[model samples]
Target: MPDAGTLQLSGAGTTKTLPCHAGYLSVSGKNNTITLTGHCTSVTVSGNDNRVAVDSTDALSASGAGNVVVYHWGSPKIVSAGTANVVRQG
Candidate 1:
């Protein structure tokens, strides 16, 4: 995901450092940790115990249990589903 494109990930107990300038990012499966750089149009996370960091995003959708999302810039519209998911601006 080095340029503007869609990135979709699915797995368990994995760690990834994503590239910059993404158009959209989607994650499924559990216990995956991810870090996203640059700007993105949208970020969607599903499943449990996933941790995500974004430099900036226009929109964020987080679903499932115990997921955490942190944004560095912009006031993005957030839509959350399921239990105990945390979306924060930092």
Candidate 2:
């Protein structure tokens, strides 16, 4: 298991810089794939940024200079910062 849900992501963004955060990461299962519906701040994703996993019971939360939103089943969950990971396969 992961020591914590949100792991720090080193490099990402338009400048291609790394912000030590765990934001805007996507996770999938064997049966289903979950796409991030939206977010609070500017998010960047690459192979390195997407380096973690999560459970259905768990979720990724994030907030920056702008805002953060976590959506599950069309509902919203809030957090200052968070991580999302693939749990199982369908």
- Name the candidate that leads on lDDT: 1
Candidate 1 per-residue lDDT over residues 1-90, each given as its tens digit: 847789999999989887658589998999999999889999999999999999999999999999999999999999999999999998
Native-referenced Cα lDDT, model 2: 0.28
Cα lDDT, model 2, residue 10: 38
> How do the residues 1-90 of candidate 2 rate in per-residue lDDT, one tens digit apiece?
122223223333312122223344432212221233222122222232332222222344432222222233322233343343222221
Worst 10 residues of 2 by lDDT: 28-37
RMSD of each candidate relative to the true structure: 1.0, 12.7
TM-score of model number 2: 0.23
- Model 1 TM-score (2 dp): 0.94
> Per-prediction count of colliding residue pairs?
0, 12
Error (Å) of candidate 1 at residue 50 is 0.2
